[model samples]
Target chain A: MISNKQILLLTSLLIFSAASILFSLLSGSVDITLAEIAGSILSAETNLNSQVLHQIRIPRIQAAFVTGGLLALSGAIMQVLLRNPLADPYILGISGGAAVGALSAILLGASGFWLSNAAFAGALFSIFLVFGIANKFGDWSVTRLLLTGVVVSAGWGAVINILLTTSSTNNVQSMLFWLMGDLSQSRVNLAHYLLLIAGLAGGLLLSRSLNVFIRGELLAVSLGVNVQALRLLLFFSASVFTATAVTIAGSVGFVGLIVPHMLRLLGARDHRFLIPSCILLGGSFLVLADSLARTIVAPQQLPVGVVTAVIGVPAFILILRSTIRK
Target chain B: MATLHIQSLTLEVAKKTLCRDLNLQIQQNESWCLLGRNGAGKTTLLHSLIKQRVIDEGSVLLDGTDIADLKQRELARKIGILFQQGIEALPATVFETVMLGRHPHLQSLLLDNEKDIEIAEQALAVFELDSLKARPVDTLSGGELQRLALALLLAQAPEIFLLDEPSNHLDVAFQIKLLTVLTDKVREASASLIMATHDINLASRFCDNIILLLEGGEALVGKCSDVLTEENLSKAYGCPIQSVHSGEHRLFYPA
Candidate 1:
């Protein structure tokens, strides 16, 4: 059953998400005042402010929000799937594979759309590689899967280093930006939104079984959950979510790891509440971080990944401390 | 009524035969105890009965249907198992943990109904854990955790219960109380019970049938009066055992 406190938390997160989106839109290089934004929206004005809002800010905000939602949702699912609290979307080599793809693309003079496609293809390749090796014996244990993922991730890291070492200085800077997660050139379409919504809906549908699953695999099996089927679904779903997010944002860090932990610390441990709350809180967190990234240096933009870690580490520490005190 | 029939079953672990040609018929409302020392295959036998473990040979049937043919959900409705180890520490509350027992019955994508909540609450009350329903499971003590596990099994209400070392970590008083409650529940529901344990006295006191697993894959299975003798237990345990009759009850001790 959903408690009143959980309902309140969800409501607060929804409000926070809206406010963050608004803040990101209003505070850019050329700061548009509240009245100017309102006038542009209320009337069909072709003002410069409106042009910037429609063409640039709107798409970037959507990309950031959806990417964050996808990452956090994947992280939550991964923690349950691996039954390890430290497990994030990237722990399974998806991000490393994507990094290798994007780095290689940068070296080959591929920019924009091709770079994104390369990253996505790399992510898929890593997903299958890890899965194929782990399930080679027909029945894959959790330990085997985790070990396989870790080893594959290490291999990807080595390839990424080689690409970085051989690249020219100018190419290296762009490669570093991509590695640190830049959203300046990021955009989203209808499909990204649909994927986020589908992921949320699917997560909610599986929430109850996930609650039982967290206890243990054997316990879930005894409780009539199709453990093998549920595990396969979780693996692929988390992989797809991670792949899509990395493709859009280039390995934005900490949002996935911190958002779900924050929700759990705030007493929303149930999957039904945890899943939706992860989307709301994660999207808002990234929006706020990206806003700070854009405005803190004003035009000389820091990477969103740096901003996320800068904000996320201290916030996570505070939450962890308070929970331990309780 | 539900029944379990094991036909000409054989089991091995790491090339060592655990049992051979073991036939057992567990009828409705019966209580069976598996008594053996460490590595005596009590747990292995229990797992095999529920199809959780692969048997070397033969079939295990639930009401004349082979268990291998049944889906996991179908099997869950008819049988429940309590593992030997304590539950892992998680962020779930006591009530939420017990409510998981209703998972097999609840439909997908639907919230638990009022009846499911009531059942969970009643299970908590039965274990004297009603006051701690909202407490996190990780905070429970060993004895309390054991009681909680038993309460969850009660809520599950399967036709057959297979427990591995069910009495582990329980105090003397709670041990008797909980075992009595289990036997009473089994009798009232006309369900069967198969428990594996090292406590000979407890097995003699609670079970109607005894299965003594001995060395080299041999076994002795019969009524409690016939199978729970000093000679049988000593042979099964690889040690001398002495028994004394006290007020219509026979208690065994190491000699």
Candidate 2:
């Protein structure tokens, strides 16, 4: 028998996703009618306003949806991989490492085309470093992995701070803005970016072997799961997804840390359900958060990160409290 | 038929020899009990037989194939292991936990089919655990959990059953019940049942064969009547042990 809360959550996510896309199209700084926006998406050449709407608004909306969705999915997968309720996307130092890479590339005057690449490489490298340190201790203890992740994150944080201190004022502002997470500057094709997200999402869904891993590494190995290979593969894919999200929209907070657990607390433990729910809800939540950030201050805008944290913390606390009672 | 051959198996952990130069065999249709005092490596020897603990300098062969060469699932298919203690912290229902026995049989993507459910239900029926099927495992009393573990092992449908201290947490009645149920299974399936126990009397009464393990790295494997002598018990336990026999059953008492 299915719980009513699960049905409610699934229903709410679908409704929110539809509403978020509509809001994404309608409620930007400059208002555009729904009909005109539809016309712009359908026939860009027929309407002058269509060109501005298609180029500027559509990508921003898609970026918010995809990045938010993927980050939440990554958070869910990572928590299960570590078997710790508190684990999230940043627990492996992926975001911290990506920040260092993105900032370094920016400060060193790299072209816009290379920014995402540098960030992806940095995230991969930091995850490898953390994994190496954890391996040195001879077991994948959650406490060891968490401590190692913190140390690696601190190391990357120091590097980014040092770069910021030495860089010119102009570069520092850009670095700070990116680190704060802004989707206003993203202009990538939605189809291309969605493909990467879908692939990583597919890989995570295929990790049903992870169910055995949840029992313990020894149990997983004894159950015919290649524990080491599966661990490395999961680490690599989760980091790539996080790095791509970072590259696309700077570094958004809270969504990656909060949404997957929220789904789980709402009774979706199976990854097949949890992962897709995260995608839909995460994308919709972030888009809604971004929209709120734009409109809350009227003519001025707050950072989307600030909006998400403000909205996410209380809900997260409520979920945490309820889960403990359970 | 399942046969296990352990040739000179030794295990050392943290520079202490847990088991040294141990050799044993279990043929089909045999119920063998390992008798030892605390820290005498009875459980370690059982673990070695099941391939849970890697042997240092020997080979464990099952049905003529090296255990190390078998895939974990394949090994599990041939041998069912009941741990010394129940694993807590998982909020698994008795049915779900018992269904885990089918892990070796079912693919990860597929749900437990009717055949798997039938096997699990049969196991539950054998152990008389159908009434407690929906209870969370952690909530069960020690005896109930032990019975549940036995049911799980039965569901695994293994050719050999390896149990570590199956009677440790049980009451006298449950202990006898567990042993009788296991002996019955061994008889019915033509499977070898190997158990580690500190209760020599229970071992002698219920087991067809007994291996008396001494603390100083010696193992005496033979019939129960041959191994449970006062001299051997006292030497292995490092204390004065007196024995009394009633019919085929022998009881060991500390003097």
Candidate 3:
């Protein structure tokens, strides 16, 4: 099952991710020379270059990569759980609900970490709403569950629209930009990194269960997996992941929807390989995309979400074409 | 001892009564056929044994153990079923798909043992799926998938087999081939089989016992020869039925 082609792709993806991290630390409004970068790494820091490298760029790059990996892995889990190719980490309205919560908190004069907490709460709320609605009478048919998610997501979208319309005009521009997804002020804290790492490991550990669960509930049950319990566990874990991603960088859309799918195209069918590959590829994809967003126009920044779709679409098409050929 | 015993079972589906006060026992080494027309409660009755649909009025015992008392894993190891339409777009290969039958017996959560692989390989070869072993289940045809499913069930190595419309999409040649293989397997293991199929010739060819389920929960259950008569089939199907002898075999058809 471990083809050399897969090994090569995996190795290349890992190298690309590492390289992206290094380049992200280097390329920004304040460009540190290669010598300065090396000197900072070699020695201690009294210089502003090292300060920017460690405090600003390092954590920002880490946060961006973690968010990307979390979203992509979560999206992959959701796709199999819902059995819909279009299912994403935010398909259950987690991001939409997060947006509403974050926006409302901002409207109420909450800033900084509180806004992210509120967004996380909103994601939890959405997860509970969807779970409750679908678990009614124990009917967890894929179509019903999918329809419920879409409808709830639409409801959250309407609430977001209303919040935008009702908010004071002064806060409107900033909120709109945040809604479009900006990570410039995102908290690149230690806890966020730990959570992402733990989530990735947990996903790998559960990948075998996912392999059975993905096929269908009946088969999962037949295989002695408690399908209902596994479903709840996957749904909530993915919700938490989407919450983390949205809390970090607003809604970086296509990384979640596209990275795992692209990995699948490269013959990473088993979840054991698929989940970890998603971690590596997703981290590289968004880090590179965010780097482009920061340096595309220099000094003036676009939201990374915008850059993500633009980069993801054509890359996905090429991958799709290659996969179809195979 | 009976492999499966259903006691006074009452089942209802979508406001229609599928069975009521139904009692049956399937002994080890026996192959039983559920002979009935569409909606004759063949599927509903069979599913109750696996705890898919809970019966309100009675209990199904597996080796004198109440099915409700057994956990999912133990029950799965004891009784395996092939549904009418299994997962078609499963991402696993035929080998992997068949290997999944080892799940109930797997001691670890992540990996399968070589014995599990050996058993799966044997089942795949017997079911004629060895050539498609590496192909993903999604890429398989209906007949191929059917054979793969049967191989998977066989790999499970359950004591009781419940096959619902097991030959729905199979060609005649494959149907005979698969059943002939299965017959030999069950005899060797002294396991029991309960198959719900529309093909009467298949029942006459393999089954030792047959149940003719009539409307209103009236059932005629006995030896295959005694219960699968034209009068009972016509009454159950609500149509004219005639029995014919083709040399050494018996076949039933609509008149």
Best by lDDT: 1
Question: Once superposed on the true structure, which residue ranges of model 1 sit more than 4 Å away at CA?
Answer: B107-110
Give the Å error, residue A284, model 3: 2.2
Chain A only, candidate 3, TM-score: 0.95
By the lDDT metric, which is better: model 1 or model 2?
Answer: 1
Residue lDDT tens for model 1, A1-326:
66898889999999999999999988888878889888887899898889998888888888889999999999999999999999999999999999999999999999999999999999999999999999999999889999999999999989988988999999999888888888888998999999999999999999988998999987888888888899999999999999999999999988889899999999888999999999999898998899898889987999999999999999999999999998
What are the lDDT figures for the candidates, one per model? 0.90, 0.77, 0.83
Q: Extract clashing residue pairs from model 1.
A: none
Docking class of 3: acceptable
Q: In model 3 chain A, which range of ten residues has the least summed lDDT?
A: A1-10
Q: Pick the candidate with the highest DockQ.
A: 1
DockQ of each: 0.70, 0.35, 0.45
Ranking by TM-score: 1, 3, 2
Q: Enumerate residue pairs that collide in model 3.
A: none
lDDT by residue (tens digit), candidate 2, B57-147: 8889998899989877788788877778644435546886677677677644534477888899899988889998877676888778878
What TM-score fits each model?
0.97, 0.87, 0.94
- Give the lDDT of residue A277 in candidate 2: 80
- Residue A208 accuracy (lDDT) in model 2: 48
